[model samples]
Target chain A: MVQPEKARSKIRIYMDILQAVQDDGMAKPTRVLQKANLSHERLTRYLGELVQKNLVKENQDEPGVRYYTMTEQGIRFLQELRKAESFVSGFGFEF
Target chain B: MPFPFLYLDTSFYFLSGIVAFLVSFYAFRYTRLIENSALRFLSIGFTVLGVGLLAEAFIDTLSFFIPSTSSYLLLHRLIIREAAATYSFLQVLAYFVILMGYLLSRRGPASAASSNGSMNRPPTIGFLASATSVVLASRLGELGVLIALAREIIIISSALSMAFLVAIIYLDSTGYLKHRNKQAILVLVGFVLILASQAISFSLGIVAARALGFSEILDFIGTAVQFAAFLSLLLFLIWRGKIGSTGKSAQ
Candidate 1:
């Protein structure tokens, strides 16, 4: 479970959405909205960006219910982000 | 007055340089992953430092290989002196930029993580060019003597910068303890060892060990300690990567 952060940057928000999707395994729109704390419009816009960036993929199993899944690049990006955060945080930064 | 344990000292620096360059590679990769200017600066700083250490090692090796003729000796001296000055200057600059990155991270995380807008050319390049010019200029006429004198001062200042880096990392480690971060503890220990190494190097002043056995001993100890510091960081990174793959914290 990812802890909800306050006033995240655009990048941070992207990370949050990715983490939420990863946590959910096959993230439904409502679950991601609740986890990312973004309105439908905002979530839609960011999800498009994430899909375009190749960090996230939008898939539908049956019909209308869209599930967001993290791509390989997305997972790698998250891992790198964690390492970078820890690297600098070792120097007292809340990265 | 040939140096004692010269090969050992150079080997340690070479190993340390290899480690620094490895870390720099990963840091630079991370900058591409994230939108953090601090990460970019940190990457650049470590790259400069890694290259500087390697340069020093190369210069030391060159001294041994250069033909001992009078003209060769003069050329050798000029090359080593200029290289040493540049190495010292880079040491200071690298540590200073790293310090600035940490400071910026603390003050305004947002600003520090912001994209490099309008920063067409990094300030580091200008610093290197200017510092190189000043060091090269000191190689002229009567000022050459002054450069010889100033070389010791530069080395001392470089050691002090290392000390300053240790202090900053040490302070940062206290916060790490509060967060119960094992990785940070490893980094703290590494810096402490590096700090001790720099202090020994500063006090020894053994560019040419003139039968001073104690200075040689101190130099050996410093080299050994610095190697350990680099090893610690390397191990931490490796261990952290393993844990990260498992989605767990080492703490």
Candidate 2:
């Protein structure tokens, strides 16, 4: 029997988003949507939360053009999240 | 740790404690990174069990080094027995905690996520609960031993704890089956070996009745199997966490 794919966990999503932003140094929403494979609404909401958490910063210095860049905290968070992911999954968890 | 009952092999217990410590460390260290209460409980369970094994190991070492000609032999032996009762208590408690983790995790991921900040006080509470039980059980266990009933009770309780663990591991294996995970298969086999060791020891009566030294040989085999089980899990955890990971598989 074919098993249904497990949904991406919230932490996984966060990791992907952080990685997407970090890869380009700074990223637009569309780029993040493409890289992270998230819907526009989810990317906006998650990015907003990440920004509020100080993991990410959204810049809108130029009118109507915004970019998301990873904070030092965000980079650290991603690295730790990756490690944590590896840690739990190694023990046969869903992660 | 195998319930050798009378055997005080300090080195074996000490090494078992170290292996348990490493496994518990792996489970405990990542709790801050994830909102999984199951992980937290697994951490707590292993931590309690590891501490119990290490403490028992120390007490056993103390008992082992003193000469039989020493005047304090009887008193030290009493201390060691009492310590074994405590160790047994902690072993059962550890299994209970791990079982509770499995039970709670069955409630699904949402509940685990909701439990994020609510768990800060649990370790303290757990410590307080167990500390009180340790005092009562350790002292009362001495009296129980004088009456020759404590060992029986310990065996029964240990059996129940083993039952709980068997059920949990059975469930865990089913999950592993679903995933077809080879690493999990290694873990499953390891657990099976440990359980089989217990089964062998528990039948020591029947085995001993059939032959004299055969039971002792079986005892040695059981201990070896238990040690191998611990070593296998420890090595798997190290490999999975370090060199074997590609970081994409979990995601």
Candidate 3:
């Protein structure tokens, strides 16, 4: 049976990004984009928003090489969203 | 004892209660996961529902085991009546709490912490309901008058709780439409069925019931319908939990 794909929520997208970063240790943007299953344009926009929100921090190891790690706020946000998602989804609710 | 049980039976209420508890258990787990105190109202309601039905079953079972000999028949009836009243009061309370929880959930997280305050707790109502039950249980010689008053109390409380159920069903309908959730639809159906059952019982509460002379019959029908409703919920919740979501995945 083919299940139709549902549109991912913004929070889901954000969490996917955070999760990718969390899994990668210090996440490269390329890897985060792939793991989060987002297009380059969308990833750039979301990552920028995330960094601005202080949920993710950007670091330059050397000159132009950028890596991201989840800020404490980002980790907490992801955890809370995960909890809310599981709970509300069980009831077929819009998280 | 024989008359009431003959109509309502013990198993229906007891079994329905177990279903309510299962639903409540699910809610409780979510509350812990989210660390939200507001959701506790929803869980608490289901727990009370389970307890009330189970208690009714326990009381009925206790009465059944007692000697129904002619000498003890009066005492038996008294006990049965009181137990039924107690169960009714609990039903009223369970519905009330569930309604409150549903409303609070809609209001969202801001209300959650503040709701923990004593003001939200209906301690007086609980005290009055439980106190009435205790009064009935003591088997004081004033059985006739006290039982009549208890019946009125049950009727009024049941009416109030049904109002609560109405509000919940209304909110649920709007919510269900937006979510398109399968299990939620099942729960909504269950609520409607229970409400129908309440209507049947409401008929029994009216003076017309004695004139109709089918209190036992109406009571039985109501219990059976309620039992079926709860059973449906229990079965579906378990079944759906395995299959997982319908792919809606909103909020």
Error of 3 at B210 (Å): 2.5
What TM-score against the true fold does each predicted structure earn? 0.77, 0.73, 0.69
List model 1 lDDT by residue over B1-251, tens digit each.
24557788789879888887877776677666666676666677777778877877887787778764765655555555555556666666677766666666554557876645232233356346545555566665544454454456456655766766775675567658655777777767777776777666666554532434575576578678978988887876776677657755334
lDDT string, candidate 3, B63-153, tens digits: 8877878877656656655666666677787787777666765654445534561224343455467576557646665655555555565
Give the per-residue lDDT digits (tens) of candidate 1, residues A40-93: 999999999999999999999889989999999998876666666566555455
TM-score of chain B of each: 0.76, 0.73, 0.82
Worst 10 residues of 2 chain B by lDDT: B144-153
Q: Each predicted complex: what DockQ?
A: 0.37, 0.28, 0.13
DockQ for the candidate 3 complex?
0.13
Ranking by DockQ: 1, 2, 3
Clashing pairs in 3: A94-B250, A94-B251, A95-B250, A95-B251
Interface RMSD of each: 2.8, 3.4, 6.1
The lDDT of model 1 is: 0.69
- Candidate 3 on A8-93: residue-level lDDT in tens? 65666887898898788799999998899999999999999999999999999799899999888887776655555544533433
The candidate with the higher DockQ, 2 or 3, is 2
The per-residue C-alpha lDDT of model 1 at residue B247 equals 56
Displacement of residue A67 (Cα, Å) in model 2 is: 4.8
True contacts kept of each: 0.42, 0.18, 0.07
